[model samples]
Target chain A: MPIRRLLVANRGEIAVRVLRAARELGIQTVAVHSDADRESLAVKMADMVMPIGPPQAAKSYLNVDALMKAALDSGADAVHPGYGFLSENATFAEKVESAGLIFVGPTPEAIRIMGNKSLARETASKAGVPCVPGSDGVVDSVEQAVESATRIGWPIMIKASAGGGGRGIRVAHDADELRSQMTTAQAEAQAAFGDKSVYLERFIRRARHVEVQVLGDGKNAVHCFERECSLQRRRQKILEEAPSPALSADTRSRLCESAVQLARSVGYRGAGTLEYLYDDVSREFFFIEMNTRIQVEHPITEMITGIDLVREMIRIAGGEPLRFKQSDIVMRGAAIECRINAEDPDRNFMPSPGKVHEVILPGGPGVRVDSMLYPGYTVPPWYDSLLAKLVVHAEDRPTAIARMRRALRELHIEGVKTTRGLHLTLMDDPRFQAAEFDTNALEGWLAARAPAASPTTTTSP
Target chain B: MAHHEVLSPLPGTFYRRPSPDAEVFAKEGAIVKVGDVIGLVEVMKQFSEVQADAAGKIVRFLVENEDAVEPGQPLATIETA
Candidate 1:
């Protein structure tokens, strides 16, 4: 399909990102916003703005009918679901196609297959990709969980088959804990993913979270190398870097190749990320799940490979083949990205949404800030607190870390409390600098350094 | 002593009347009891009625038809009769 006018069925930084890319391609953009985000940056940047609904995400971003109506009403030829919200929703993808608007993503079948962790694992194993040792199907009872755990060995991880973002996952040390954790995991999974299907996997303690970016046009696929996203809190990636410092040349090659193989097997098209849990000690990587949308950490990959992933996705959606072959791809300098959020890390990462009184983005050699914030811009409280992404690229990991620390120090945002101070502290931590950390590193580091008393609380201007 | 505030339970586009030509459900000087349908808010193509939870007189209409409202945003000010 030749996408002329595009309706972005998302909001915040991603919406702004897509609008910019579409505008650069001479594609008219229609931005849909909830009542809370009527005056948001994305709405202001787009050619046309439509009100989807109110502040609640269920009534706005997740409303497939409303999104389709907006696309139809705005005369949009295609709908682009940026990451999060309804981006991975197979039903929404199918509905978009049925509504006659080109869904700028993978087919609904691909989404459905990848949306479920258990099914995805089966698919990966069939494709000869190493999958985490786990059950091949959903575990319905405690007995079933225990059986799977015994087969997979003790210290197994119970995960919601339909879950993501670290939710609906419970690590059990023994049988008793597994029994209790299984029920909790099931309840959480049902509440969060609307699917109570739970599965078991051998938990890799102190494992590094790494992922490879892949682009495909169903028949052809290419890998954009790997990103080390070990820095996480509550199962959400807080910081990510490309050209993972932890991987050797051979490991990196194998990881990328595995990701490409899986993408080709699924007939994957558009931009996707093949996530894996890497055990540094064993030097083994296992496929976790595939995110079938533009990722928040795509900038790091873009910096290292010089590929505009969003542009590639749009081109592929327009039925274009891979513009560059695997041989043409190159991974250069290391790139790091820190998510700047409208939150007070000192206060348990509580959101501090308000107006921006002053804004000064870091600008120096290898420093890049992707944001839509300007002085006097109000941060709405209804959506994710992420305000911007601070990205830096250098010839090596050490240089990239140093550059990120410098950029963070130079960057300043006022009128709301931000995680800037926390990011600065994290950058200065020796463990983080050495990249000798796991997914749990951030939480432990923060808990240890947390103030004896309530940390400095900043109010809105 | 009594206190009352008319509010919306869900987020949507606030509409003052059933239709453009119809009389508004509530207006200045109009008295309403608890559970009275004061207005309608359209969310995702579904129109949900916003009811008055207290017995009062409509003192002021804080929002007009087609106004985008958030959850708990006051749609009208109701003064206890």
Candidate 2:
């Protein structure tokens, strides 16, 4: 049956995104919000609003029972979990399905298999996808870890079996450090992810973050090329650009093929991203993880391909078979996205949640702003710091970069300090202008900009 | 009497108890010791216990049972033991 009404089980710009997609598809939307979000833009845009619970996410968004009750009460037949806060939760998906409502994403089993990083790596390897050389599974002990490190080479990454968003990870340069850090890493992983199992991988230096966006129909999948997301702050992506300047034509094709193969192997559905750590020295890429939901940086892909990813996900959830084949999908031009967060970059990227007194979103040719910001809007401190996503598209990478720079200047926000100034500095930096930086670039850049110029990271990469 | 503030570590909602069905961790006028959990802060569905780093007598709570809170927001006051 076609979805009559959809319940958006999220907040922020993503919530607004889902509401717009549903409206385009001629489906009604029900917005569920905690008390803190009563005046949010999503609540205003929604056809109907329901109180999920109190301000706390546990009693609100993350509470499966509360979400179900809200969906049922609002007469919604489906739930769109917009990235984060139970978006990739397997048990939540199962519960939604058992409640006789459509879960707008991949199958629960697929999520389960790929949610565990070690299991996903093994599955990717079995599907003939290239993975970073490391332990077969979670290392049994420090002795086993040492042996594996010797075989895998030096500079290793210890990762938790069930970690995401850049948590539960430690990097060691030698066996002595690995042995000393093993207990600490395991304890951290256990505390953070509730899973102590840790695995090791050959940590590649001078790495670029490349990921392929794939849409699957449970039988096959198609790739929409790749996005270079190497510019990150504290391991969290802050900016992304499509058609990476680093990839050769041959490497790009191989990357897409590998991503599609892995997605098909799991009978994936809806939109998913296969992330990789690209070695700049060897030009080899290894599987990192798979995000089984729409990513925050998806607009850059959409800008170049003209494919509405949110609409595609809604259609797939509605049981429509993905019609486009590998040949049919085309990627043109270059797109870049800057995540404008409500953070004071000068103060260690501290969250700056307050009332948005004034707003001026850049609008011109090749510029688009996906935001939930409005004058007099109070950014609640109960969730992520992301306030908006500024995206720009042009015929090529250089033009895209120039357009983004222009948009960053045109954009204006008041009342709360933001990363806008930081982005401005990055856009003007000679190194960033050449795109000659890796995943660790932002940290080095920030350190140099610091008044003290901490000795920990002096030379800005 | 001088009171010590028990500030929440992160933003979310302040809970006076572990769960909805449980009793409040500490009551007004109750004696509390260092490292004692006075309340809970719920953020991203993760509950962080608000421990009394300084021993004190439980003063009146400042926030309600499920009021929204931000980082460093005072959840309650603790009088010197």
Candidate 3:
């Protein structure tokens, strides 16, 4: 059954992106908003609007009951969870399907299996996908941790099995350090998560964040190459590009094939990304996890592959089979995306949520700006600081970089202090041009430039 | 009663406690020192302490815990020292 009306269960740029795609598919759109987002671009663009709750995300966007009510009341036949929020939530997906509405993503079972790290790792291993060497299960004692660490290698990470957000995680390079950290990790885990179970895994230094985009229609799956998001801060990807400059043709094929294999193993459907940790020196990749929804940096992949991923996902949700086979899709060129956030980079990237005075978006041959910003729009502080994503594509990486530099120059937003200057500076940097950076590189680069800069010194130039 | 209003420094959600399971930083009628943390204003996932500018007794909290606040919005009221 084709979806006639789609309820967008998200906010900000992604919500707008989904609404546009749905409209393109000749589907009417219903945008659900909190009190804070009544005047949001997405709400304005939607065919119908439903007031869910208040400004707090818990009471609004993340409120499953409120969203379902809106969906049913608005007569929406399908719901598009536009990344973040509850996109990867298995229970929410199940609820949507149970309500007799299409969930524009993978099956709930696929989401559940991939949601747990250990379960996903086990599944990947069963499918012959390489995973980071680690303990078979939770380590109960120091002896068990040590035995696993020695087998893993010299530098290993002691992590609380129950902990998240990098808490109760200790990286130790030797046996003595591992022993000392193991006790503390276990205790911290017990105190934090009330679970003393801890695990050990090899710590990869200078690891690159590479992920392959795949589309599946239950029976078959195909990979859309890979994206390199090594330049990150606080594990948040600030900039992204494709195809990975670090991957050789043979390695890229192997990596892409592995992702397809994993997707096929899960009997996946819709759009999903399999995240991998790539070691530049060793030229080895390890499957870390899978995101069972469209990713934030997905536009870069779309730019290179010339596939509207959101459109494809919507088509798949409408019960269509894989439109294009692996042979049908071809990657054309390099693309780069800079996440323009409402943040003051000079002030340690402090969130700058206020009125967007004058908006001058960069647009030319290959530049695309995905944003919800408009003149006189007040960005509410109740959510993520991502204001826009400026993406550019060219014949090659250098040309793409040059196009990005030009696009960034043309881009200008008054009133709010954005990360435009930081992106501009990065564009001129030789290291970034050569793509000689890792996951931790951006934080270090920001720290090195911190001392010379003072608080709230706007770098808008 | 002479009262001074404690304002939120940034526009975001105001939390009276540092964490969910903790007690409110300042209780009503409790004496607090200047620069004492009264609440936390979370803006775009970044938490910053909302400090009491005046040493006095907290008359009452102007906003409930987890309320959406704007810059310069009164968070609490304090009796004069």
TM-score of chain B of each: 0.90, 0.92, 0.95
Output per-candidate TM-scores for chain A, rounded to 2 decimals. Answer: 0.95, 0.96, 0.95
Which runs in model 2 stand beyond 4 Å of their true positions?
A453-461, B1-81
In candidate 1 chain A, where is summed lDDT lowest over 10 consecutive residues?
A: A452-461
lDDT of 2 by residue, A326-404 (tens): 9988889999899999877776665667889999999999999999999999988788889889999999988887898
Candidate 3 on A389-447: residue-level lDDT in tens? 99999999999999999999999999999999999999999999988999999988887
TM-score head-to-head 1 vs 2, winner:
2
Ten contiguous residues with the weakest lDDT in model 3 chain A: A452-461
Q: Could you give the CAPRI-style class of model 3?
A: acceptable
TM-score for each model: 0.83, 0.88, 0.92
- Model 3: how far residue A373 lies from native, Å: 1.4
Q: What share of the true interface contacts does candidate 1 keep?
A: 0.00
Enumerate residue pairs that collide in model 2: none
Fraction of true contacts retained by every candidate, in order, equals 0.00, 0.24, 0.47
Local distance difference test values of all predictions, in order: 0.86, 0.88, 0.90
Error of 3 at A152 (Å): 1.2
Ranking by DockQ: 3, 2, 1
Q: Each prediction's interface RMSD?
A: 13.2, 11.2, 6.7
